[model samples]
Target chain A: AQSVTQLDSQVPVFEEAPVELRCNYSSSVSVYLFWYVQYPNQGLQLLLKYLSGSTLVKGINGFEAEFNKSQTSFHLRKPSVHISDTAEYFCAVSSFSGNTPLVFGKGTRLSVIA
Target chain B: GAGVSQSPSNKVTEKGKDVELRCDPISGHTALYWYRQSLGQGLEFLIYFQGNSAPDKSGLPSDRFSAERTGGSVSTLTIQRTQQEDSAVYLCASSDRDQPQHFGDGTRLSIL
Candidate 1:
């Protein structure tokens, strides 16, 4: 089984400021890394994914995550944030192959203040 | 034309009552998944279905919970004699087994 832990539970940042959300995983086998965002009363939206290839993977809305194999971490970063970025962020992991279920972290609430 | 959709966006039931939640996946998605989200808790996988076959049900909390997918499209999660702990948001997602999943708004189930 795979497990993920996001370091922060709440992050309040001023708009246009840089932000980073740390995530670490525990798994004996290889797994896929993913980051999803959820707004109020809505389901999650995929932000970025780390399948293979480039260590740094970028996704929608200026979000990026770097896959560090040695540390078993895939941390999401954004150079600048907007107030619209305020939402609950989740880091999830699953097996690279087979029918594996996603194991998610508790969640990190990003409050982008103006 | 539409994304994953779930019926009865909000459901309120008393403890000991049975409740069913429905999920309609994308037209061509071959894989569907069900997850539960409780207050202050992250999304927890409950069951998985791929092209009409299910191989994972380990995340289901107990035997009181069951789910079935028909025609590889629509799925229903049923909770028998629901308990207070059953209150949470139930989410449905669908993919083609190789693509990113699309999710529904989810159905919030509240047990009184």
Candidate 2:
């Protein structure tokens, strides 16, 4: 079985400032990592996914995440954040090639301040 | 074409009543999924459908929760004798393969 953990429950950062949301996973076999964001009253949108061949994955909306195999971590980062970026973020892990169900983290609330 | 669509954006039902949530996946999306989000629980996988076969229903917390995808397009989730703990947002997602999943706005079910 695979599981995910989000280190922070909430993170507040000023607009245009860089921010990172930490995520870690536990799995015996190789897995695919993903990041999703949910705006107020909206569904979760895919930010990015790490399948293979790349440790650093770039995503839409000026966001990116790095996959650390040894540490089993996939932390999302953005060089600069906007007030609109304030939302809920979730990290998920699934078995190789998406053969299994995704295990989602508890999620982190990103509150961007202007 | 557009994305996953869920009906009845918000539903409020009294305790002990049954509720049904609906989802319409994008055209030709072979994979579909259902999830629940509570106040503290981020997202919990409820069930998945690949074509007409549902091989994984392990995430279902109890027997009262049931889901069915018909004609490989739309899915309906039924909760029997709803409890207060059953109040939450239900989300639906669809994928074409290993591709990223597209999500619906979700049906906000509130059990009162």
Which residue pairs in candidate 2 collide?
Answer: none
Model 1 spans > 4 angstroms off: A97-99
**Where is the poorest 10-residue window by lDDT in model 2 chain A?**
A94-103
Instruction: Give the clashing residue pairs of candidate 1, or none.
Output: none
Model 2 residue B102 CA deviation in Å: 1.5
lDDT of 1 by residue, B82-102 (tens): 999999999998887557777
Estimate the TM-score for candidate 2.
0.97
The superposed Cα distance between candidate 2 and the true structure at residue B27, in angstroms, equals 0.7
Best by lDDT: 2
Interface RMSD of each: 2.2, 1.7
The residue-by-residue lDDT of candidate 2 on B8-99, one tens digit each, is 99999999999999999999988888999998777999999998779999888899999999999999999999999999999998887777
Q: Name the lDDT value of residue A82 in candidate 1.
A: 99
Model 1 chain A — which ten-residue stretch has the worst lDDT?
Answer: A94-103
Place model 2 in a CAPRI quality band: medium
